[model samples]
Target chain A: SQQGEEDPQALSIQEGENATMNCSYKTSINNLQWYRQNSGRGLVHLILIRSNEREKHSGRLRVTLDTSKKSSSLLITASRAADTASYFCAVGTSYGKLTFGQGTILTVHP
Target chain B: GAGVSQSPSNKVTEKGKDVELRCDPISGHTALYWYRQSLGQGLEFLIYFQGNSAPDKSGLPSDRFSAERTGGSVSTLTIQRTQQEDSAVYLCASSQGFGGAEKLFFGSGTQLSVL
Candidate 1:
Protein backbone atom coordinates (compact mmCIF):
# COMPACT_ATOMS: atom_id res chain seq x y z
CA SER A 1 0.00 0.00 0.00
CA GLN A 2 1.18 3.52 -0.72
CA GLN A 3 1.85 5.61 2.32
CA GLY A 4 1.43 8.95 0.62
CA GLU A 5 -0.92 10.13 -2.11
CA GLU A 6 -0.95 13.49 -3.93
CA ASP A 7 -4.01 15.24 -5.25
CA PRO A 8 -4.71 16.76 -8.70
CA GLN A 9 -2.67 14.45 -10.86
CA ALA A 10 -1.97 17.22 -13.37
CA LEU A 11 -1.91 20.98 -13.11
CA SER A 12 -1.27 23.85 -15.55
CA ILE A 13 -0.53 27.44 -14.72
CA GLN A 14 0.82 30.61 -16.27
CA GLU A 15 4.20 32.00 -15.35
CA GLY A 16 4.20 34.18 -12.22
CA GLU A 17 1.24 32.23 -10.82
CA ASN A 18 1.38 30.07 -7.75
CA ALA A 19 1.04 26.29 -7.67
CA THR A 20 -0.02 24.17 -4.75
CA MET A 21 0.16 20.41 -4.32
CA ASN A 22 -1.18 18.45 -1.42
CA CYS A 23 -0.15 15.06 -0.07
CA SER A 24 -1.84 12.91 2.51
CA TYR A 25 -0.37 9.88 4.18
CA LYS A 26 -1.26 7.10 6.56
CA THR A 27 0.70 6.14 9.66
CA SER A 28 3.05 8.34 11.65
CA ILE A 29 6.05 9.96 10.06
CA ASN A 30 9.35 11.51 11.00
CA ASN A 31 9.65 13.79 8.03
CA LEU A 32 8.13 14.53 4.65
CA GLN A 33 10.16 15.50 1.57
CA TRP A 34 9.38 16.93 -1.83
CA TYR A 35 11.23 16.00 -5.02
CA ARG A 36 11.10 17.12 -8.61
CA GLN A 37 11.67 14.99 -11.71
CA ASN A 38 12.23 16.12 -15.27
CA SER A 39 11.07 14.08 -18.23
CA GLY A 40 12.62 10.60 -18.14
CA ARG A 41 15.13 11.60 -15.50
CA GLY A 42 16.02 10.98 -11.89
CA LEU A 43 14.31 12.92 -9.14
CA VAL A 44 16.01 15.92 -7.55
CA HIS A 45 15.48 16.62 -3.88
CA LEU A 46 13.66 19.89 -3.26
CA ILE A 47 12.76 20.43 0.38
CA LEU A 48 12.19 18.38 3.49
CA ILE A 49 9.94 19.28 6.41
CA ARG A 50 10.21 17.40 9.65
CA SER A 51 7.19 16.30 11.60
CA ASN A 52 8.04 18.76 14.31
CA GLU A 53 8.01 21.60 11.84
CA ARG A 54 4.76 23.25 10.80
CA GLU A 55 6.31 24.90 7.76
CA LYS A 56 9.55 25.43 5.85
CA HIS A 57 10.75 27.60 3.04
CA SER A 58 13.46 27.28 0.42
CA GLY A 59 13.73 29.93 -2.23
CA ARG A 60 10.29 30.02 -3.82
CA LEU A 61 9.27 26.64 -2.45
CA ARG A 62 7.21 26.51 0.71
CA VAL A 63 6.32 23.29 2.54
CA THR A 64 3.91 22.74 5.39
CA LEU A 65 3.44 19.65 7.48
CA ASP A 66 0.44 18.82 9.62
CA THR A 67 1.16 15.75 11.67
CA SER A 68 -2.24 15.91 13.29
CA LYS A 69 -3.82 15.40 9.92
CA LYS A 70 -1.05 13.30 8.39
CA SER A 71 -0.92 15.68 5.48
CA SER A 72 1.53 18.05 3.82
CA SER A 73 1.49 20.76 1.20
CA LEU A 74 4.03 22.16 -1.26
CA LEU A 75 3.57 25.65 -2.64
CA ILE A 76 5.71 27.06 -5.45
CA THR A 77 5.59 30.83 -5.53
CA ALA A 78 5.97 32.80 -8.75
CA SER A 79 5.99 29.64 -10.81
CA ARG A 80 8.23 29.85 -13.82
CA ALA A 81 8.54 27.83 -16.99
CA ALA A 82 11.60 26.22 -15.50
CA ASP A 83 9.44 24.85 -12.70
CA THR A 84 7.59 22.57 -15.05
CA ALA A 85 8.05 19.02 -13.85
CA SER A 86 6.58 16.23 -11.71
CA TYR A 87 6.45 16.86 -7.99
CA PHE A 88 6.31 14.02 -5.47
CA CYS A 89 5.86 13.94 -1.75
CA ALA A 90 7.58 11.21 0.25
CA VAL A 91 7.13 10.19 3.85
CA GLY A 92 10.06 9.20 6.00
CA THR A 93 9.49 6.95 8.95
CA SER A 94 11.38 7.17 12.19
CA TYR A 95 13.43 4.09 11.39
CA GLY A 96 14.51 5.37 7.96
CA LYS A 97 13.49 4.73 4.36
CA LEU A 98 10.91 6.65 2.35
CA THR A 99 7.46 5.88 1.00
CA PHE A 100 6.52 8.06 -1.97
CA GLY A 101 3.26 9.33 -3.44
CA GLN A 102 2.17 9.04 -7.05
CA GLY A 103 3.01 12.74 -7.69
CA THR A 104 1.50 15.81 -9.30
CA ILE A 105 2.47 17.02 -12.75
CA LEU A 106 2.92 20.79 -12.88
CA THR A 107 3.19 22.61 -16.19
CA VAL A 108 4.18 26.25 -16.06
CA HIS A 109 3.39 28.15 -19.22
CA PRO A 110 5.31 31.21 -20.37
CA GLY B 1 32.50 15.79 -6.48
CA ALA B 2 30.84 13.49 -8.93
CA GLY B 3 27.15 12.68 -8.45
CA VAL B 4 25.72 9.21 -8.27
CA SER B 5 26.26 7.55 -11.64
CA GLN B 6 24.35 4.73 -13.35
CA SER B 7 25.51 2.72 -16.31
CA PRO B 8 23.90 1.90 -19.65
CA SER B 9 21.60 4.93 -19.59
CA ASN B 10 19.18 2.76 -21.50
CA LYS B 11 18.72 -0.96 -22.13
CA VAL B 12 16.40 -2.93 -24.39
CA THR B 13 16.13 -6.60 -23.55
CA GLU B 14 13.99 -9.53 -24.51
CA LYS B 15 11.57 -11.06 -22.11
CA GLY B 16 12.96 -14.08 -20.21
CA LYS B 17 16.44 -12.59 -20.41
CA ASP B 18 18.46 -11.36 -17.48
CA VAL B 19 19.73 -7.79 -17.06
CA GLU B 20 22.21 -6.19 -14.73
CA LEU B 21 22.15 -2.51 -13.80
CA ARG B 22 24.99 -0.86 -12.01
CA CYS B 23 25.33 2.23 -9.81
CA ASP B 24 28.41 4.07 -8.49
CA PRO B 25 27.65 6.37 -5.59
CA ILE B 26 29.39 9.54 -4.63
CA SER B 27 32.56 8.98 -2.66
CA GLY B 28 32.14 8.85 1.14
CA HIS B 29 28.44 8.04 0.96
CA THR B 30 27.53 5.17 3.25
CA ALA B 31 24.04 4.43 2.10
CA LEU B 32 22.61 3.38 -1.27
CA TYR B 33 19.13 2.79 -2.60
CA TRP B 34 17.43 1.35 -5.70
CA TYR B 35 14.04 2.38 -7.07
CA ARG B 36 11.88 1.67 -10.09
CA GLN B 37 9.69 4.21 -11.86
CA SER B 38 7.05 3.13 -14.32
CA LEU B 39 5.17 5.39 -16.67
CA GLY B 40 2.68 7.49 -14.73
CA GLN B 41 3.69 5.70 -11.54
CA GLY B 42 5.63 7.07 -8.63
CA LEU B 43 9.09 5.91 -7.68
CA GLU B 44 9.01 2.53 -5.96
CA PHE B 45 11.70 1.51 -3.55
CA LEU B 46 13.47 -1.74 -4.44
CA ILE B 47 16.30 -2.22 -2.01
CA TYR B 48 18.57 -0.36 0.38
CA PHE B 49 22.07 -0.92 1.76
CA GLN B 50 23.89 0.83 4.54
CA GLY B 51 27.50 0.34 5.50
CA ASN B 52 28.37 -3.28 6.52
CA SER B 53 24.92 -3.98 7.88
CA ALA B 54 22.57 -6.33 6.07
CA PRO B 55 20.59 -4.83 3.22
CA ASP B 56 16.90 -4.05 3.55
CA LYS B 57 15.45 -6.34 0.93
CA SER B 58 11.85 -5.95 2.03
CA GLY B 59 10.98 -3.56 -0.77
CA LEU B 60 11.87 -5.99 -3.59
CA PRO B 61 8.75 -6.78 -5.59
CA SER B 62 9.57 -10.39 -6.32
CA ASP B 63 12.17 -13.10 -6.05
CA ARG B 64 13.38 -12.32 -9.57
CA PHE B 65 14.59 -8.92 -8.42
CA SER B 66 17.74 -8.68 -6.37
CA ALA B 67 20.46 -6.13 -5.59
CA GLU B 68 23.78 -5.96 -3.79
CA ARG B 69 26.17 -3.29 -2.67
CA THR B 70 29.92 -3.89 -2.81
CA GLY B 71 32.42 -2.21 -0.47
CA GLY B 72 29.62 0.18 0.53
CA SER B 73 30.34 2.27 -2.55
CA VAL B 74 28.85 0.65 -5.63
CA SER B 75 25.73 -1.40 -6.06
CA THR B 76 24.15 -3.62 -8.70
CA LEU B 77 20.55 -4.60 -9.39
CA THR B 78 19.82 -7.80 -11.21
CA ILE B 79 16.56 -9.02 -12.64
CA GLN B 80 16.33 -12.58 -13.91
CA ARG B 81 13.88 -13.94 -16.44
CA THR B 82 12.46 -10.51 -16.90
CA GLN B 83 8.91 -9.95 -18.00
CA GLN B 84 7.26 -7.15 -19.91
CA GLU B 85 6.05 -5.71 -16.65
CA ASP B 86 9.68 -5.20 -15.67
CA SER B 87 10.07 -2.42 -18.17
CA ALA B 88 10.69 0.75 -16.24
CA VAL B 89 13.39 3.23 -15.35
CA TYR B 90 15.73 1.93 -12.69
CA LEU B 91 17.10 4.69 -10.50
CA CYS B 92 19.89 4.62 -7.96
CA ALA B 93 20.47 7.10 -5.17
CA SER B 94 23.06 7.55 -2.47
CA SER B 95 23.17 9.39 0.81
CA GLN B 96 25.75 10.21 3.39
CA GLY B 97 23.92 8.15 6.02
CA PHE B 98 21.02 5.84 6.48
CA GLY B 99 17.34 6.80 6.84
CA GLY B 100 15.28 9.56 5.25
CA ALA B 101 16.62 12.63 6.99
CA GLU B 102 19.79 12.59 4.93
CA LYS B 103 19.59 14.22 1.52
CA LEU B 104 19.72 11.68 -1.29
CA PHE B 105 21.69 12.21 -4.48
CA PHE B 106 20.24 10.45 -7.52
CA GLY B 107 21.61 9.19 -10.80
CA SER B 108 20.00 9.85 -14.15
CA GLY B 109 18.73 6.24 -14.10
CA THR B 110 18.74 3.43 -16.65
CA GLN B 111 15.65 3.18 -18.79
CA LEU B 112 14.91 -0.51 -19.25
CA SER B 113 12.74 -1.62 -22.10
CA VAL B 114 11.60 -5.21 -22.17
CA LEU B 115 10.29 -6.65 -25.39
Candidate 2:
Protein backbone atom coordinates (compact mmCIF):
# COMPACT_ATOMS: atom_id res chain seq x y z
CA SER A 1 0.00 0.00 0.00
CA GLN A 2 1.19 3.53 -0.74
CA GLN A 3 1.93 5.52 2.39
CA GLY A 4 1.60 9.00 1.00
CA GLU A 5 -1.24 10.59 -0.99
CA GLU A 6 -0.83 13.79 -2.95
CA ASP A 7 -3.53 16.36 -3.50
CA PRO A 8 -4.38 18.03 -6.82
CA GLN A 9 -3.74 15.13 -9.14
CA ALA A 10 -3.02 17.66 -11.87
CA LEU A 11 -2.23 21.35 -12.02
CA SER A 12 -1.79 23.77 -14.88
CA ILE A 13 0.01 27.06 -14.43
CA GLN A 14 1.74 29.77 -16.41
CA GLU A 15 5.46 30.33 -16.45
CA GLY A 16 6.67 32.74 -13.74
CA GLU A 17 3.76 31.74 -11.48
CA ASN A 18 4.21 29.79 -8.28
CA ALA A 19 2.99 26.22 -7.94
CA THR A 20 2.19 24.44 -4.72
CA MET A 21 1.72 20.69 -4.16
CA ASN A 22 0.58 18.92 -1.00
CA CYS A 23 1.20 15.41 0.31
CA SER A 24 -0.29 13.53 3.26
CA TYR A 25 0.93 10.34 4.80
CA LYS A 26 -0.62 7.77 7.07
CA THR A 27 2.13 6.82 9.55
CA SER A 28 5.05 8.47 11.26
CA ILE A 29 8.16 9.03 9.24
CA ASN A 30 11.83 9.61 9.88
CA ASN A 31 11.97 11.95 6.92
CA LEU A 32 10.16 12.98 3.77
CA GLN A 33 11.64 13.59 0.34
CA TRP A 34 10.31 14.91 -2.93
CA TYR A 35 11.21 13.64 -6.41
CA ARG A 36 10.53 14.76 -9.94
CA GLN A 37 10.16 12.55 -13.02
CA ASN A 38 10.55 13.74 -16.57
CA SER A 39 9.21 11.92 -19.63
CA GLY A 40 8.44 8.89 -17.46
CA ARG A 41 12.06 7.85 -17.55
CA GLY A 42 14.02 8.59 -14.38
CA LEU A 43 13.30 10.35 -11.13
CA VAL A 44 15.46 13.11 -9.70
CA HIS A 45 15.71 13.81 -6.01
CA LEU A 46 14.47 17.28 -5.21
CA ILE A 47 14.39 18.13 -1.51
CA LEU A 48 14.36 16.23 1.73
CA ILE A 49 13.06 17.37 5.13
CA ARG A 50 13.95 15.37 8.17
CA SER A 51 11.43 14.74 10.91
CA ASN A 52 13.13 17.28 13.14
CA GLU A 53 13.11 19.95 10.48
CA ARG A 54 10.11 22.10 9.67
CA GLU A 55 11.16 23.73 6.41
CA LYS A 56 13.91 23.69 3.82
CA HIS A 57 14.76 25.63 0.71
CA SER A 58 16.77 24.93 -2.44
CA GLY A 59 16.93 27.50 -5.19
CA ARG A 60 13.33 28.15 -6.15
CA LEU A 61 12.06 25.06 -4.38
CA ARG A 62 10.71 25.34 -0.82
CA VAL A 63 9.51 22.37 1.23
CA THR A 64 7.60 22.26 4.51
CA LEU A 65 6.88 19.38 6.83
CA ASP A 66 4.32 19.22 9.64
CA THR A 67 4.86 16.10 11.67
CA SER A 68 1.79 16.72 13.77
CA LYS A 69 -0.42 16.66 10.71
CA LYS A 70 1.60 14.02 8.91
CA SER A 71 1.68 16.23 5.85
CA SER A 72 4.17 18.08 3.65
CA SER A 73 4.07 20.67 0.93
CA LEU A 74 6.29 21.70 -1.97
CA LEU A 75 6.34 25.18 -3.43
CA ILE A 76 8.05 26.11 -6.67
CA THR A 77 8.55 29.83 -7.10
CA ALA A 78 8.61 31.49 -10.51
CA SER A 79 7.89 28.28 -12.32
CA ARG A 80 9.21 27.67 -15.81
CA ALA A 81 7.99 25.44 -18.61
CA ALA A 82 10.92 23.22 -17.84
CA ASP A 83 9.51 22.74 -14.34
CA THR A 84 6.65 20.73 -15.76
CA ALA A 85 6.80 17.16 -14.58
CA SER A 86 5.38 14.65 -12.15
CA TYR A 87 6.20 15.38 -8.51
CA PHE A 88 6.09 12.63 -5.92
CA CYS A 89 6.38 12.68 -2.16
CA ALA A 90 8.11 9.76 -0.53
CA VAL A 91 8.00 8.89 3.14
CA GLY A 92 11.16 7.55 4.67
CA THR A 93 10.78 5.20 7.57
CA SER A 94 13.25 3.76 10.08
CA TYR A 95 13.14 0.45 8.21
CA GLY A 96 15.25 1.97 5.42
CA LYS A 97 12.49 2.02 2.85
CA LEU A 98 10.85 4.84 0.97
CA THR A 99 7.16 4.73 0.04
CA PHE A 100 6.00 7.09 -2.67
CA GLY A 101 2.69 8.84 -3.20
CA GLN A 102 0.51 8.89 -6.30
CA GLY A 103 2.16 12.18 -7.38
CA THR A 104 0.99 15.44 -8.88
CA ILE A 105 1.32 16.24 -12.58
CA LEU A 106 2.32 19.86 -13.06
CA THR A 107 2.07 21.50 -16.46
CA VAL A 108 3.61 24.91 -16.91
CA HIS A 109 2.62 26.85 -20.03
CA PRO A 110 5.42 28.81 -21.61
CA GLY B 1 29.88 5.30 -15.00
CA ALA B 2 28.84 8.80 -13.89
CA GLY B 3 25.35 7.67 -12.82
CA VAL B 4 23.05 4.69 -12.43
CA SER B 5 22.65 2.68 -15.63
CA GLN B 6 19.97 0.24 -16.76
CA SER B 7 20.02 -1.98 -19.84
CA PRO B 8 17.53 -3.07 -22.50
CA SER B 9 15.76 0.27 -22.42
CA ASN B 10 12.79 -1.47 -24.04
CA LYS B 11 11.65 -5.08 -23.97
CA VAL B 12 8.73 -6.87 -25.55
CA THR B 13 8.12 -10.41 -24.39
CA GLU B 14 5.43 -13.01 -24.87
CA LYS B 15 3.21 -13.98 -22.00
CA GLY B 16 4.60 -16.82 -19.85
CA LYS B 17 8.17 -16.03 -20.86
CA ASP B 18 10.73 -14.77 -18.41
CA VAL B 19 12.63 -11.48 -18.70
CA GLU B 20 15.61 -9.98 -16.91
CA LEU B 21 16.27 -6.29 -16.27
CA ARG B 22 19.64 -5.05 -15.16
CA CYS B 23 20.76 -2.10 -13.06
CA ASP B 24 24.25 -0.85 -12.43
CA PRO B 25 24.33 1.57 -9.57
CA ILE B 26 26.82 4.34 -8.95
CA SER B 27 30.16 3.05 -7.84
CA GLY B 28 30.50 2.37 -4.09
CA HIS B 29 26.83 2.92 -3.33
CA THR B 30 25.52 0.31 -0.91
CA ALA B 31 21.80 0.62 -1.29
CA LEU B 32 19.74 -0.29 -4.37
CA TYR B 33 16.01 -0.22 -5.06
CA TRP B 34 13.56 -1.37 -7.76
CA TYR B 35 10.24 0.21 -8.57
CA ARG B 36 7.51 -0.22 -11.16
CA GLN B 37 5.25 2.38 -12.67
CA SER B 38 2.25 1.93 -14.91
CA LEU B 39 1.07 4.51 -17.36
CA GLY B 40 0.18 7.76 -15.60
CA GLN B 41 0.69 6.15 -12.18
CA GLY B 42 3.07 6.63 -9.31
CA LEU B 43 5.95 4.28 -8.65
CA GLU B 44 5.37 1.08 -6.71
CA PHE B 45 8.26 -0.12 -4.61
CA LEU B 46 9.36 -3.60 -5.70
CA ILE B 47 12.45 -4.51 -3.70
CA TYR B 48 15.48 -3.14 -1.88
CA PHE B 49 19.05 -4.30 -1.30
CA GLN B 50 21.54 -2.76 1.13
CA GLY B 51 25.06 -4.05 1.30
CA ASN B 52 25.10 -7.79 2.10
CA SER B 53 21.96 -7.61 4.19
CA ALA B 54 18.98 -9.71 3.12
CA PRO B 55 16.93 -7.75 0.61
CA ASP B 56 13.49 -6.49 1.61
CA LYS B 57 10.95 -8.26 -0.65
CA SER B 58 7.76 -7.23 1.04
CA GLY B 59 6.63 -4.97 -1.77
CA LEU B 60 6.85 -7.52 -4.56
CA PRO B 61 3.39 -8.08 -5.95
CA SER B 62 3.73 -11.82 -6.43
CA ASP B 63 5.99 -14.87 -6.42
CA ARG B 64 6.77 -14.35 -10.08
CA PHE B 65 8.79 -11.22 -9.34
CA SER B 66 12.31 -11.55 -7.92
CA ALA B 67 15.51 -9.52 -7.84
CA GLU B 68 19.13 -10.02 -6.86
CA ARG B 69 22.13 -7.75 -6.31
CA THR B 70 25.54 -9.25 -7.13
CA GLY B 71 28.85 -7.96 -5.74
CA GLY B 72 26.84 -5.24 -4.00
CA SER B 73 26.83 -3.24 -7.19
CA VAL B 74 24.93 -4.61 -10.17
CA SER B 75 21.37 -5.79 -9.69
CA THR B 76 18.95 -7.81 -11.75
CA LEU B 77 15.17 -7.96 -11.60
CA THR B 78 13.56 -11.04 -13.10
CA ILE B 79 9.93 -11.67 -13.78
CA GLN B 80 8.81 -15.18 -14.61
CA ARG B 81 5.74 -16.22 -16.55
CA THR B 82 5.14 -12.66 -17.55
CA GLN B 83 1.57 -11.47 -17.86
CA GLN B 84 -0.01 -8.47 -19.48
CA GLU B 85 -0.46 -6.91 -16.09
CA ASP B 86 3.29 -6.96 -15.68
CA SER B 87 3.81 -4.46 -18.46
CA ALA B 88 5.24 -1.28 -17.02
CA VAL B 89 8.41 0.71 -16.57
CA TYR B 90 10.92 -0.84 -14.19
CA LEU B 91 13.15 1.71 -12.50
CA CYS B 92 16.31 1.22 -10.46
CA ALA B 93 17.83 3.54 -7.89
CA SER B 94 20.82 3.54 -5.58
CA SER B 95 21.87 5.56 -2.58
CA GLN B 96 25.15 6.16 -0.80
CA GLY B 97 23.84 5.05 2.60
CA PHE B 98 21.50 2.51 4.15
CA GLY B 99 19.12 5.05 5.60
CA GLY B 100 15.98 6.20 3.83
CA ALA B 101 16.98 9.81 4.33
CA GLU B 102 19.76 9.47 1.82
CA LYS B 103 19.14 10.82 -1.67
CA LEU B 104 18.94 8.34 -4.53
CA PHE B 105 20.34 8.32 -8.06
CA PHE B 106 18.06 6.76 -10.64
CA GLY B 107 18.45 5.00 -13.97
CA SER B 108 16.49 5.62 -17.13
CA GLY B 109 14.49 2.41 -16.51
CA THR B 110 13.40 -0.48 -18.73
CA GLN B 111 10.04 -0.35 -20.42
CA LEU B 112 8.60 -3.86 -20.33
CA SER B 113 5.83 -4.82 -22.65
CA VAL B 114 4.29 -8.21 -22.02
CA LEU B 115 2.39 -9.26 -25.09
Number of the top-ranking candidate, with lDDT as the measure: 2
**Candidate 2 regions off by >4 Å?**
none
- Tens-place lDDT per residue, model 1, A1-110, is 53689988999999999999999998888889999999958899999898889999999999999988888999999999999999999888776678788999999999
Query: What TM-score goes with each of the models?
Result: 0.97, 0.98
User: What does candidate 1 score on TM?
Assistant: 0.97
Q: Over the stretch B75-96, how does candidate 1's per-residue lDDT look in tens digits?
A: 9999999999999999998888
Worst 10 residues of 2 chain A by lDDT: A1-10
- Number of the top-ranking candidate, with DockQ as the measure: 2
lDDT (0-100) at residue A15 of candidate 2?
100
